[model samples]
Target: MSTYLTILGFNSAIPTVKSAPTAQFLEMEERCFLIDCGEGTQVQLRKAKAKFSKINHIFISHLHGDHVFGLPGLISSFRLLGRETPLNVYGPKGIKAMMEAIFKYTETYQGFEVIFHELSSKNSEKIFEDNRVEVYTIPLDHRIYCNGYLFKEKPKERHLNMKEISKYPEIEICDYHNLKRGKDFILKDGYVLKNEVLTTAAEPPVSYAFCSDTRYLESIVPIIKNVDLLYHEATFLHDLKEMAEYTGHTTALEAAKIARKAKAKKLILGHFSNRYADYQVFLNEACEIFPETYLPQQLEPVKI
Candidate 1:
């Protein structure tokens, strides 16, 4: 199955009537990942009809309130619901202390275990991995310590060609697993059948990169090179690039440039400022450099 990404909120620092702050839901290989828990994320998840219990991992980009203000409330809800599985949260160095302080003031003990994996490395590093997917941190240039995340699906098994396998009656159903694993089949007489003849090549692995609340930095291009889908923050227009640099945010034009340099297949421009009412302006600006650019549709899932 393909990966799907849902944008829960896509506004800038403020939550407007039309949009909220930065938050996203990524589903890869049946695993749920929440990227940034902005305010009202729980409500947004309900609106999206997401499977809340499957969200065992959350990735926070920075300490900004707009990016992380909704975490305490979500955990509290989990506690009330009696979640027994452990939840892993990955973020900057002080994330553990911040969450602990919040929990200390509110409810003391939680029924479920909340594991906080604090990160302080300025360079890119592998932070999460399972049998199906792996995640890496992309060091970002922002006002404070921040990071973007890259999610990549692991290599898949080759497809079984039943038509070819039917030629040999010796190949039983129990041997199909080996064929899908790209292993050759051998008969009792020692005649070997090549794996390429019995199975087709597997599809290329899919990858996604999330770049939130960062200035125009070229260093991240190499880390997210050739990403299947890229979601980068575009908080301003090109005319206000100076202000964007001062505030540690990227303009739509600069975001497109980064996508072009990284050779991303699809680029998504989000985290829009409230001043801009029309999203077409952001689309027009980014499409000039990258044609596959898209705007965020609230709670709508995009297949990657």
Candidate 2:
């Protein structure tokens, strides 16, 4: 199975000629999730060629206009598309009311059911989980109540060694399931085969952390430590560090420092402020602290 993340939008507050606000699409285990539906998010999704029908869940980081203005438009479009699948939206308090008001004012009714999951917690907590993946909230420090999501893949089943299993003609196809579950195989001759001998260990689980629209916060380091990939907001360059903190946003240096402290495998910097015409300054500042940092472009999918 492959895990892919497409950068739909990465700019902060304002949309520029090259970027929009904060929106991303994460595809894992054949399931799709949208994070932060900023303005122009639906258009970005279309440009990225994301399967809009497959996105059952959307997670909003905060109530900022740049972060949530596109939700009503997207929901309305879904109605126009005649979608029947229920859409699950997770966000901070007041999201449901805000969305409902828009629908009511516009006299728009969705053809599909819209389920809202309101978040009120101020600590890290598991919000969603299934057999294949789990999602947790990373309490973020911002002017308003905000949260980042951490998506982690569940440990997979061991791969069956076909060559070893082929040696036993007595083994039925159904028996392969048990072998993958780490059960020893018992032959008709009463010979017991160790599970380790018949299967290879599964790949280690992968984790992705999305942190955006927040100030430099160290408290979250423990929760996201050693994450495979971290998408942290770098809203400004180091020269504007004071302005970033004043606006409850993080500078590139601060974001890189957080990644370094957490021992994250890789860092993807985003949420750029449109004021900076040169994005290379952000990359240069971050790379000085965390060499594995990356700057993603819109519509490009980064496979993990």
User: Could you give candidate 1's per-residue lDDT for residues 1-304 as a string of tens digits?
Assistant: 7799999999899898789788999999899999999999988999999989899999999999999999999999998888999999999999999999999998657899999999889999999999989999999999999999999999899999999999899999999888988999988999989999999998888999999989999999999999999999999999999999999999999999999999999999998888898999999999999999999999999999
RMSD of 2: 1.3
Estimated TM-score for each candidate: 0.97, 0.96
Runs in model 2 deviating more than 4 A are: 188-191
What is candidate 2's TM-score against the reference? Answer: 0.96
Query: For model 2, what is the alpha-carbon lDDT of residue 72?
Result: 93
- For 191-303, candidate 2 gives per-residue lDDT tens digits of 99999999999888888999988999999899999999999999888888799889999999999999999999999999888777888888999999999999877899999
**Cα-based lDDT for every prediction:** 0.94, 0.93
How far in Å is the alpha carbon of 156 misplaced in model 1? 0.6
Total residue pair clashes for candidate 2: 0
Model 1 error, position 285 (Å): 0.9
Residue pairs of candidate 2 with colliding backbone atoms:
none
